[model samples]
Target: MSARLVLHGVCVGLLFAALAGAPTPAKAQKIYIETDLEGASGVYKFSQTREKDTPPNIEACEFLMGDIAAVVRGLRAGGAKEIIVSDGHGSQAFLPRLMEPGAKYVTGKPRPSSGLDETCDAIVMVGCHAMMGTPDGVLCHTQSSKSENRYWYNGVETGEIGQSAIVASYYGVPPILVTGDEATCRETKKFFGEHCVTVAVKRGLAREAAELYPFEETRKALFEGAKRAMAELPNCKPYQVKLPIQAKKEWYELDAKGVKGKLMTREGEILDLRDLYKF
Candidate 1:
C-alpha cells in the first residue's frame, strides 16, 4: 500500500472513533414527584378517596391525572428529561398504569428515601391535602384520614406535604412546587419559604366539599407553577426539619375505618404516641 493512502486511512479511523465517543447534548435532569388526590381540582367529594374495591368515580382519577400531566408538561418545558411520580395518597389512589408518559410511577406503601438524593434537581407535590383536622379543607387529614386525628413533627402539626418534604430533605433535595387547597398551599409556602411555587386548586369549604377553580384555569396554573419552580431551582433549598424529628399521631376512635393503619416511614423512628409529642 502507498504511504499517503495508509496515513489517510489511519487519520479517518481516529476521527470516526473520536466522534463516536463524544457525549450527546442535553443531559437529562431528574425530577421527583409526590402526588395525592384529595386537593386535586374537581375532586371535592369524600367518596373519591374513600371508594370501595373499585374506583367508583373515574372523573376523580382523571382530575388527579390532569394535574400530574400539567406539572409534568411544565417540567418538560423547563428541561426535565426524567421524572419519578409517586402515589402519595393512602392506598392506591393514583394508578401506575395511567401515569404520564416517559415517567416512573411508584405505588404501595413505605417509600424508600435512598432513591432520592442531592443528585436529583428538585421535587414537586400535586393534589396534597392539608393537615389532619384542618378546618375548611376538603378531605383534610394526615396519613390516614380515618385513623390519624393529627400528626406533629417536632411539635408542629403537618400533613403529607410536610412529612414527605422532610423525608426528601434527608437526601438533600428541596421541594419546589406544591399544589393543593388554598390552606395547604399556604402551609407549604410557610414551611418551604415564599419562593416555592404554591398552586391552589380549590377553596376548602368543609371536610368533604370545596369550591374548585375552573379545570382549564387550574391546569394552566399547575403547568406555570411547575415551570417557575424548575426555572428557579437554584433558589430552592432542602428543608431540614432537624432530627431526631419527634413525631406523634393522635389516634381516632375504633369505629373509624383504617384506624389501625400504619404511617409511612423514611429513616423515621416512631416513638410512643404520648412520650415525644405531649399535649
Candidate 2:
C-alpha cells in the first residue's frame, strides 16, 4: 500500500475516536418527585387517606401510584437521567410493585430529608392537596388533618406545598411541576408562578367533595404535564422563603377524649428552612 494511503486511513480513525468522545448537545436532568395521597385521582374523602393498610387507603395509594407512573414515563421520555420519588404522604403510601421503572423510590419513616440534593435539576410534586382552611380544598389540611394544622411564614399563610418548595429552594432546586386538585393548582400558581406546570385532576367543591376526573384523562394530563415541566426547567425559578423566617403556627388542642378541641397558636422564628416542618 502507498504511504500516503496508509496515512489517510490513520487520520480517519483518529477523527472517529475524537467524535466518539465529544459531548452531546443536551444534558439529561436529575429530577426529584415529592408525592402525597389526598390529591390523587379519585381521592376526595378522608376515609381514603386517613388510615393505613385499610382497603380504602390501599385503593387510594394505587391511584397515586398510577399517577406517579404517568409522570415518570413522561420524565423518562423527556431525557431524565436520574429520578428519585419520595412518598410524601403522612402514612407512607408506596406500593413497590406499582412503582415505575427507571426511578428510585423512597418510603418509610424518619427519612433524613425530602430525598432532594444539590445534584437534582428539578422537583415535581404529585398528588398535592390545597393548604389548610381552603374552602374548596378537597380533604385539605396542612400537616395534620385531625389537628387542622396551619402555618404562616413572614406573615404569609402557607401550607404543605409551600413548605416543601421552601426546602427544595434551600438546595437551589426549582419546582418544575405540581399535580393535584383545582384548588391545589391554584395554590401552586400563587406560590411558584406560571412557569411551573400544574395539572389538576379534580375540582374541589368542599373539604370532602370534588368533581373527580376520569383516570384516563388525568393520567394523560399528568404524562403530558411532566414533559412540559421538563421543558420548563429553564423558566421555573427556585421558590424563596426569606430565612430567619418569622413563623406562626396554629392547631386544635387535643381534649381529654383524644378529640380536637380549642384552637391553639404559637409564634417563633425558624433559623433554617429544613426546620420549617419541625413545629
lDDT, candidates in the order shown? 0.78, 0.92
Query: Residue by residue across 50-147, what tens digits does model 1's lDDT show?
Result: 78344555668778988998999998897788898877666556655567786777777665532566677788999888887778777888766766
Where does model 2 exceed 4 Å of error? 1-28
The candidate that wins on TM-score is 2
Angstrom error at residue 134, model 2: 0.7
Which run of 10 residues does model 1 get worst, by summed lDDT? 270-279
Candidate 2 residue-wise lDDT at 2? 100
**lDDT against true structure, model 1:** 0.78
Query: Model 2: what TM-score?
Result: 0.90
- What does candidate 1 score on TM? 0.78
> Cα lDDT for residue 212, model 2?
95
Cα lDDT of model 2 by residue, 1-279, tens digit? 999999999999999999999864455479999999999999999989987999999999999999999999998887788999999998899999998998999999987666798899989999999999999999998988888889999999998888999999989999999999999999999999999999999999999999999999999999999988888888898999887999999999987776978999999999987777786
Q: Which residue pairs collide, candidate 1?
A: none
